[model samples]
Target: MDDNNSFQTLTDYSLQVFQLCRLLWGPIETPKNVQLINQAYFEDQQRRHLLSNWLHQCILSQPQQEQWIMQNCEFLSRGLLNDCVKFAHDEGDLRLAALVHAASGSNTVRDILRHCAHEDIVDVYSKDFRRTIAILSGEFIVKGHNLVDQNRTTYWQMALALHLWFANSASDSVSTIVRDFESAYQEHYWLEPIAHHGNTKALDLRWKLLKLYTDDTYPIDNVFDVNSYTQNPFDYRL
Candidate 1:
């Protein structure tokens, strides 16, 4: 279909879904109520899967219009967005999940990291790292707009994701990933709370060691072993 027709169809259907959501889940009028609503919605796997499929279709139709969908579409509640994020992850589309996380302000990206077992997280990164870095970037294009500066939370989480993967997995490109992360961190270091409660000194020391080790001039073994590191590398302050 043409762009205009596609946009109209999506908007209309989304509105219908929005109404249905309200009727099915009740009013999400306040923060407390929204939380309760999301909890209830989470339990409805059938509905969540349906919503996520529709969301995925919309995203495919307008790949760059995520912010437009999130800002203008009435159907996408935080609950639905979180469901989409989860769906993307389950489908092994981490890039789509990250984009939705950035666009919809969903906590599922961080939530997944926080809730999953360490082995599961390691498995995901090890398998996906060879294929993608869309989740690790600080900047993203949403609805044709360049969002050069993401929120502090998103930036920190992206860094944390990379750090965890790098710590646990062995790869030839890991040093490059470390360098990119350090650059992004330096660029956004002035932003509050990105490094708050994080062990900055340890991070700095590791960066240097990784650089040296990956350079092949020096051998640094077990420096980033996940088992030796703290359970929460960035700390629970987040």
Candidate 2:
């Protein structure tokens, strides 16, 4: 529980960074007088506001800070940034609900995720992710090549991590959940291409979010391939 750097409003960041955060954080809370054009958008804004408040309150501890950073790493690495944002927002809503309920001494998060629709449990990463859904639902005869390819590997990893994080028998550390599936930190052969594929603004914003959440030192070259803002290079080579 070291002191957090003073909270910086989204306005303090560059326009590109702010807009990217808007995508990650969802819409800001609209005024009560604002008429809702879309029910989904309204719900999103409300959830965003709630999660933001919850994070501001809960991110005071090292464990909580690590949890937030781990969540982002999983979400950011799983798919196209635009595709992942919606799922990330929904996951945050569920996490906020779970944490609130846990504080009140309830442990129903695991049951809710297990009994809900597959999509409710994790981001629809790809057809491969449908395999994860099947696995979670007790249909465990995995089909296809079962070979991890491209983002499919990350999809499986993130889905499992999310499940383990909120499960009734969940580990106390986010790193444990990662180790349960990933097992090691061997660099992927596709790292260079994956890094190159990421949008520069999105990558910068991801690093900014990571820094905001955790005080730990993660080499930027490893966390993000490069950002125009940093001019760092790919540091991980096979």
Candidate 3:
């Protein structure tokens, strides 16, 4: 096989394995210590000592473990957002920065959009968001590789659905968000298992928020009429 084909196969295999692992091991929860440490670590000198102690304990508790599996899993799931931010910092990719910031609730997206050149908006909505979505989809595919003998393709589809939910809701109303989410969900019905699985609490939270914002009006449609401002406008094709 050619190098490109080899890489594609490898990626596909990785995704399958990751999905099995998640299914077998279940969702990882954020560590309380990590949260507390992060809070103290960001404080202005007031909790420096506390932060240090927390960090020390974390290190001493598991010298070989860089972070708890839950935290690691969560971070891995957000790999695309984090990478976009890093790319923005390194290469001044404002469009990427904007998308990442918006998805992550960071102020940088607003800051970038405010001062961005007029032409940049199109690039942000079209190129940047599309690329980010593709990258994230691929990442979930890789995550699937860690799974066991289970059918991990469902997990991949679920991850993609979640990504679509976030992308479609970036700046949309509650009703629009629900519509888009339902469309995405129905697009990949195999994800029903993962969606139904108790492991996807975060996905449930997103669904809950959408329902709350939409006043409990859940759209059961297959087509999503998403707003242009949310993610990329459908008019611009790759």
Best by TM-score: 3
Task: Indicate which candidate wins on lDDT.
Answer: 1
Residue clash pairs of candidate 2: none
- Two-way lDDT contest, 1 vs 2, winner: 1
Shift in Å, residue 14, candidate 3: 32
For 1-238, candidate 1 gives per-residue lDDT tens digits of 5769756654654454454344334443334434454554344433333433443443344333344243311122222557666766776877766656664453444344333322234335432331122232322222332232233433333333333332222222434444555555666531322222244434322233334534665545534433222234552221
| lDDT tens readout by residue for model 2, 80-160 | 233334454566644433333332233354344344323334434444343323333322222322212234433222333
Clashes of each: 0, 0, 20
lDDT of 3 by residue, 1-238 (tens): 5769656644543444344333223433444555455442233232222222332332233223233222222232333346546656566667555555564664455344333423334344543343343333222122222121123332433343344333442434334534654554455422432222243323332233234334545553311322211222352211
Off by over 4 Å in 2: 1-132, 135-169, 184-238
Local lDDT at 27 for model 1: 43
lDDT of 3 at 146: 16
Using lDDT, rank the candidates from best to worst: 1, 3, 2
The list of candidate 3 runs beyond 4 A from truth reads 1-80, 83-166, 193-238
TM-score for all models, in order of appearance:
0.25, 0.26, 0.26
